[model samples]
Target: MKTFSNRLYSDYLMPSRMTTHEDLIRAAQVAGYTQTSVRDFVATLRGGRDPQHKVLIHRHDIDTDLRTARKLFDLEKKYHIQSSFYFRLSTMDIRLMREIEEYGSEASYHYEELATFAKRNKIKDRADIQRRMPEIRDEFVRNFEWIEQRLGRKLTTVASHGDFANRQLKLNNTEVLADQALRARCGIECETYDQILTDHTDIYISDRPPPQYYHPVTPIDALRRHRRIYLLTHPRQCETNWSANTKDNLHRFYEGLTW
Candidate 1:
């Protein structure tokens, strides 16, 4: 394990700037890209149709922070933009999800059922997970419906969330969605990684790749080159709060010890 001093040094080097995320959103709008939520993006491309204008699909994976989620939510709202927020079960907040929908944005599940199941059952083998696919699918359905029932709206899209178990087990939460029958039964129309959207997407940029936590090319530069783009961010990684970052680092370090 990395020592406490090393962890602190690494955390201090992490780049998290909310203003950078905000700047990208504003730049996309100015560049004539219509920012839309994943739900809206799917609806627009329904029935095998093409979008009439340039589109910027913006989304946030609310990994761990509700405060950061609201900050990003408000920032987009300030510019009259509707984006997507995929909430993990860890950070699920009904009131905030309602607010997102009230303002014309999407608040849907950021599913990690497979990972959750693996950890809970302590099953790490590929065959074990494959054999337990039925139960895994059921877990996903329950979670999906749970969110919808509480949010009081139908979910048109879902984004698969990754976790430590997923990496260790060499599995993805998205595997559950591979069952077309299950997807139809659950009324899921689009996944964040659905090929339909990926085919239309010319490029994908995200506030990922630790420490810096941003794409190499700025959103403005990318917008100048691509007509259809997918922009994803995690508010916790993008927020400009040194104290919150310190807390996050500590939490991660604790998680590492247990894992």
Candidate 2:
């Protein structure tokens, strides 16, 4: 958590070329995601309406989420609901990488760099931590490119896999990263950051990042609290149902939020 805060911020992020994959797929069943599109997404925020909500397209054990995603896509086609699917190269099966591209949904690299670094960097000095940003970014890029070359998928977005507590990376907020992404013509998309608030962008709601494994308020409650929020849910973890070694690290929302 302490190694990522020193960055030039958003230096590597590129504009998300594809529509968010999972949201587009779940949009059919997700009256909320679809509802916003139907209403042009403006009304939700006009009076602080929590409009955007999403399901995580995560693949924990692999296979199941991929197969399920294919089925979900078919259902999406049948239901005429447009959604996006974000796949993690680390978690998703490479065999389905083409499926992700073919689906016309987004393919972003979810870097586990912080998880690896946090375990390694135990020092307590902020200045010392800041020195590690460039190396960390480089490491992430190399790994990102490796995934792209192997998958033959153009990965444009960058998402931190675990909660990053790097006070030195300078990525704790949107303005810093937004300026970087603005310069690079790329940016972070909190498509599903906290669904309860419906405000995924750091600009609208930049509260403290929740501790890993903390579910906090339910999506409905979070949405009630902050109108603009992103809901992060893993298709794979949901199937696991929080089993041992499941690594249910990110925030979670029960089924009722969408229901």
Candidate 3:
């Protein structure tokens, strides 16, 4: 189980995010999660056998980015990886969401909803955000409705968007779970890594990297050590073109490590 330091780097940041799909497959073969399509991923999830590969795919922020949606769909067709796409539902690309939803790729809400709701569509910085949680979530119900309307499907799973820069946004893991749970009570079913693991102990679930914090040690290492490893990637943040910091971060984490 090598660390996530030296992952084969490819991103869909370009209109051509899928050109490296083969490279990624080869890399996954090297990492050993040789899954090539959605069924393979499902089998990993449903079967007792561990996944045969350790892989990560990044799509670069699926907001109005239809290019990413289309490209990811195409690549998923080729590789059989039923990866997850995270969307910033508040300011998300609705058109892109509509397009991506058809591909059978699972979608998760990236909670920019809090910032959009709390700030009254006006707040922008972290200090203002942290100082305003009560004032914000208290006043932000519309944002939730907005998200529900946009996705067309109710959001059952959510990942917090990296938001410290936008609002002094500190999320308590439990608090986030509770907030999501309240929504679930209304049939929204918002679940996170902790919630899934705590409730579903019989199933071998993959909670490798914590949401939005993608240092890939556990996930990649998990792949190496376990037979049924699962890996996830972000579409909006993993390419060199989108954010050099994220690229460098992944490169450093997976730097010299090989499968």
Maximum-TM-score candidate: 1
Give the root-mean-square deviation of each candidate in angstroms: 2.7, 13.1, 10.0
Off by over 4 Å in 1: 1-16, 209-211, 240-259
Top lDDT hit: 1
Ten contiguous residues minimizing lDDT sum, candidate 2: 6-15
Per-residue CA lDDT of model 1 for 171-253, tens digit only, reads 88899999999989988999999998888888888765444455866567788899998888887666544665667667656
Q: Report how far off residue 82 is in candidate 1 (Å).
A: 0.7
Cα lDDT of candidate 1 equals 0.83
> Could you tell me how far off, in angstroms, the CA of residue 194 lies in candidate 1 after the best superposition?
0.9
Compose the digit string of candidate 2's lDDT tens values, residues 1-259.
Answer: 3423311111122222113333433432443423122112322444576434532222221212454455545544554543344455435656655664565544445555543454356533545544665555555556766777877865544444533444434433122222343324332333233332233332231112212221554433443344333334444322222331133222222211221
> lDDT for each of the candidates?
0.83, 0.39, 0.45
If scored against the real structure, what TM-score would every candidate get? Answer: 0.89, 0.48, 0.54
Query: Model 2 compared with the native: what TM-score?
Result: 0.48
Query: Number of clashing residue pairs in every model?
Result: 0, 35, 37
